[model samples]
Target: MFWFLLIAMVVVIAAVTLAVVGGGESDVLPEAAPQHLTDPLPLTRPVARADIEELRLPVAARGYRMGDVDDVLGRLGAELAERDARIAHLEAALAGAQATAADRPGAPGMFDEPPADRPGDLPDGSGERGEDR
Candidate 1:
């Protein structure tokens, strides 16, 4: 029985080795030839001196200037005050113009009487008399 088993094992090993060695095969094809290609042309231009000088000009010459932080704040405050005064003056002028219009003789519906329930008893219906209704 030992001799029979040993012979079978040797036969199996030999068959496996032959199968592995004979299974490999190589396939080869021809290599492709190279083709010529052209390079792209450059499309850039140099800047002129005048262009550089224009870019270097100061901002102040273009009607803008930088001030110190405090100076800018002060100027802003002054401008706001001026605007407030102008607004007040305009409001006063508007009130005066309204008064003058109300006083005009022939303005359309300008002299119309006030309703009975109005707050004041001013004789001219102008509320200037300051009397309680």
Candidate 2:
């Protein structure tokens, strides 16, 4: 009756506990180390848009390591500055070349005068309409 059911339940609980806790034998699962970021940014080549998008910073005890964030920011800043300087230099060189070309005798300029007569027009000043006209 009730006593028989209670005894059966107790035996089942005790068996499960022993099986899980395992009388002090070595467990099947061994201790594992936490995952960490090994190689974040590429050293040989420049960082591309894809690299930035795919970057996953390693998490620290608090949130993220500050050193990694600072390093990435510094590198991106340096690259932008260098690109800006190069752009300015190229723009100056282009302006100088355009000026020299314009000063030459037969170089076409943007401010050239328009022709007095228009094409497809007759002496009467009427333009070509179509075959019907």
Candidate 3:
């Protein structure tokens, strides 16, 4: 049985070697003379100036008037004033919060207390008390 398998493997390898060496099938195209081709129609035409000048423009009228530069500048100044007021309000709020935090007890020295030895050091009775009894 082993010898039969070895012979079958040798036959398969020989067939594969023959197929590779023989360059299995032809994929090359036959040689032919190249042909020249030409375009069938004209690609472009010249535009008439009268046709262009007589064309009616279809633009919609703007709702807001953009007439004077000073008017635009005035609107921008009003918007900036509103933004400045908002910034001032936020700064006041931040200052109030900082003041309140500073006035609160244990604000600066929050971590000044010594670290507890175990989790149950503070008196809520979960069995890690230091006193013997």
Candidate 4:
């Protein structure tokens, strides 16, 4: 009886292995994704929030397809790099402009200061009407 059970288990394992490995009777293998052959990301422009929100990735046996995720990540990395470079450039330009403005102290700034001719006016920002202590 034990020998029979052992033989039965072996046969079941063999059958499963053959089914998984594709026995000599079949040469074709299942494709990972045959329907969605192309990626959904747009090639002409940088990816937007709407694009990511609308994007759908293919699913594999384990999880989302590796290639599809890789492509999306690569595109996002590129977009971030471009934005970072642009930010750095603008910051540098702003710094230069601020430095140039600093060279002149008497120049009136964008905000208006309190009038010195006003009654009880003081250089300090306090609007006090009390005695000057």
User: lDDT of each prediction vs. the true structure?
Assistant: 0.56, 0.79, 0.57, 0.77
TM-score of 1: 0.31
- Work out the TM-score per prediction: 0.31, 0.55, 0.31, 0.55
Candidate ranking under lDDT, highest first, comes to 2, 4, 3, 1
Query: Better model by TM-score, 1 or 4?
Result: 4
In model 2, the runs with Cα more than 4 Å from the true position are 1-36, 109-117, 120-133
The superposed Cα distance between candidate 2 and the true structure at residue 87, in angstroms, equals 1.2
Q: Candidate 4, residue 26: CA error in Å? A: 18
Our tally of clashes for model 3 stands at 0
Output the TM-score of candidate 2.
Answer: 0.55
Candidate 2 local lDDT, 55-129, one digit each (tens): 888787788878888888888888789889999999998888878868988767655576565545656566754
Clashes in model 2: which pairs? none
Model 4 has an lDDT value of 0.77
For every model shown, the clashing-pair count is 0, 0, 0, 0
In the range 32-128, model 3's lDDT, one tens digit per residue, is 5533222211125333445335533322244333433344346446656877999999999888877776688866533246655775665766755
Q: Choose the strongest candidate by lDDT.
A: 2
Between candidates 1 and 2, the one scoring higher on lDDT is 2
The CA lDDT at 23 in model 3 is 64
